[model samples]
Each structure stands twice: as structure tokens, then as C-alpha cells.
Target: MPNIEQFTPTEAYEALREDETAALVDVRSRAEWTFVGLPDLAELGRDTILAEWRQFPGMTPNPSFLDDMTRQMGGTTPQTVLFICRSGARSQDAAIAVSQLMEEAGTPIRCINVAEGFEGDLDGSGKRGGLNGWKAANLPWKQS
Candidate 1:
């Protein structure tokens, strides 16, 4: 069993750059993607940008998150799938869930949680995403 890893947005980006099969999975709410934006992986033309959540603006864990993710990947190959969420919490949970699901299915997928998510740290006043994540790494993202 391969160990699951936690990746910085920068490291995740580098993985995408080097591996054609590598994929970034944004597990955040639809609102997060719309409002805060996402990493621009124009290089991976066929790589998927998908949401495991069916709703918007909330942080509740989707019961079907693993199933949705399995559907998104389309198979049980041990592909490098990086999970990202609002902060790092949800993504970490998502990663663990996916890993466990894959293990049970005998697919043995490689999952990484993107530490700090899209909008990472809070500002001095307890704001979010001002310190870490894809935006903090200075990655390319489109604002909504």
C-alpha cells in the first residue's frame, strides 16, 4: 500500500507538469470555485476539473463523495489524484475517504491532499486564503 501524501499547491503543480496521467481534483463547493477561482491547468487539456459536491457554499461532507470521485476517475487505476478544498480540512477528509475506498476496491489509488486548499490562510484579522493554497503560491486562477 502506498502512503498518502500531503502536497503544497506548488508541488502539485509540478506533478501535473511532469506526469501526463496526474490530475487535480477540486473537491470544494461550486461557490468556492466560482467565487475564489482555481488553478489553470491549460497543459492538461483532457484532465478533468470536477466537483464531488452537488451543492454550493457549504462545507458539509457529501455522503457520495467517494462514489462521485470514483465516477470522475472512471476507473480504479492508481492514478495520482490531488484533492483540494476550501481550507485543508475537507480535502484531507476527502483524500482519506478516497484512499480507503480505493483500497477496499483493490484499485490502490494514490491520493494527495492539497494543504491550505485554494484559499489558504487567514489575514491578520482572521481572513482566509491570504497565506497559502494555490492563490498564495501565485498560481494562475480566474476570478469569478
Candidate 2:
């Protein structure tokens, strides 16, 4: 019965620093990662995870999301698979999907959904990344 945890950017960074085998999966779309940016988990000396959702524009749950996650996991053993998205919604879904996959395979991997994603809450102009996300936490990140 593996459960999920909510990790702040700083805590997540610290975990990555201590464990080289840990992975941070950015469930954000390619566009968001390109335009907004992503946390520099690699610079902190951990294996940065990558499994971008396969869709466009809106953050809709892809029916094959779990399949893709299984592919990404491949033969790797169950480790920390942190999921992050624009505002944490999609990441939660992703985490649940991944966790279910792991359970089905009897791996029981630990997965977490970042409470606030790359972009936090909506700003005055209804924008994100200004209130409570990775950017707001002042975590190391770079635009791609």
C-alpha cells in the first residue's frame, strides 16, 4: 500500500541531493517546460526524471498516461518518482496512475505529486508561477 506525499521545492531538492537514485518526473507539457522552465534537479546531483504528458494546449489526462509511465520506469526498481505539473492537478493524476501501474506489477513504488508545480497559483492577471510554485520558492531552474 504505497502512498503519496506532497513535497515542497526545497524539500524535494534536499531529497535529490541525498539520494542519487531518486528521480523527479516533470509531468508538465513540453510547451510549459520550454516557455516557463523546470527545476534543476540534476544540478543538485540527482537523476532528473522526464515523462512529458502527450497532449497539447490544455492539460488533459492522456488515456495512455499510465502506459507511458510504465515505459519510462522500464526495468528500474521502485524509487522516489516525484510528479509535477502546472498547478499540481495533472501531477496528482500522474502519480496515481504510476502508483497503480507499480502496484499491478507488484513493485509498490513510492510516488508523490508536488503540491504546487512549476507555476503556483494564479496571479492578479490570472497567471501562474508567481505565488507558490518552484519559481516562487526560488529553486534553481532554467528555460529551455
Candidate 3:
């Protein structure tokens, strides 16, 4: 079994900025990406890959997640891929799946989950973004 690594949003951002072969994959739904905003990697000279881990509405798992990820790679395999979602759970699942697929393909890429994700966990007030997450950490992001 392949092991999945974890990184905080800030750490992931730093790693992506420092490593030329590293990429960030946002596994959130299309709706989330449009409404909740997205992590901006423009300054790093890299675009964040948008791949849905789950469909919107019912939140069903996306059947083409792996294929979508492959297509997003654009024929270039990254040495490291960091997955992020609304929170860490979905990204962890994405990381595990990608890790297994990469291992099977003998590519052995490092699949990392962005802990705290984009929105982080719900605070005592039952709201996100207030807790520790990419947005809360004051990282650059933009809405579309």
C-alpha cells in the first residue's frame, strides 16, 4: 500500500513555490470553486489544477477523477501533487487514490493532502474560514 503525505496549506504553497515539479490540485466541486474562491498560484508561475473529487448537488464521487487528473497533467507528470478540497477529508481521499494510481503505474509520485483544506473545519459558531485554513492563513486567493 502506498502512503499519503499531509501538508498544511501554507506549507503546501511554499513547497509548490519552491519546487518546479510540484503542483497543486484543487479537488473541490465546480460550485465551490466558483463561489468559495480558489488558491491563486499565478505569482508562482503555475496554475492550480481544478479537478472535482465529487460532483455537486448530491455530492457523488466523480467517476472520472483519475482521468481528469491525468488530463490536467498535460502529458507532464509532476513529482509532487498536493490535493485540496473544502476541507481535508476529500483531498486526503484524492491523495490516496492518486498515490495508488501512481504506484501502480510505476511513476511513484508524491501525493499530498492539503490539511485544513481551503475552508478548514467549522468553528464553534458553525462557520468555516474562521479556523486555520488557506483563507484564514491569509494566503492569496481569488474568486471567479
Top candidate by lDDT? 3
Clashes of 3: 0
When summed lDDT is taken over every stretch of 10 residues in candidate 3, the lowest stretch is 68-77
131, model 2: CA deviation in Å? 1.0
lDDT by residue for model 3 over 1-144, one digit each (tens)? Answer: 667788899999999989977989999999999999999999998788998999998899999988887787896778899999988999999898888878888888888899899999999999999788999999999999
- The residue-by-residue lDDT of candidate 2 on 1-144, one tens digit each, is 346798877677777777766778888777877888878865766444566665767656567666555566674754777888878888887788788877898888778778888888898898877788888999888887
Error of 2 at 139 (Å): 0.5
Q: Which segments of candidate 1 are over 4 A away from where they belong?
A: 1-3, 53-58, 74-78
TM-score of each: 0.84, 0.83, 0.96
lDDT, model 2, position 58: 62
How high is the CA lDDT of each candidate model? 0.74, 0.75, 0.90
Which stretches in model 2 have alpha-carbon errors above 4 Å?
58-60, 63-74
Best of the two (2, 3) by TM-score: 3
lDDT of 1 by residue, 96-132 (tens): 8778877887777788988878888787889876778
TM-score preference between candidates 1 and 3, better one: 3
Of the pair 1 and 2, which is ahead by lDDT? 2
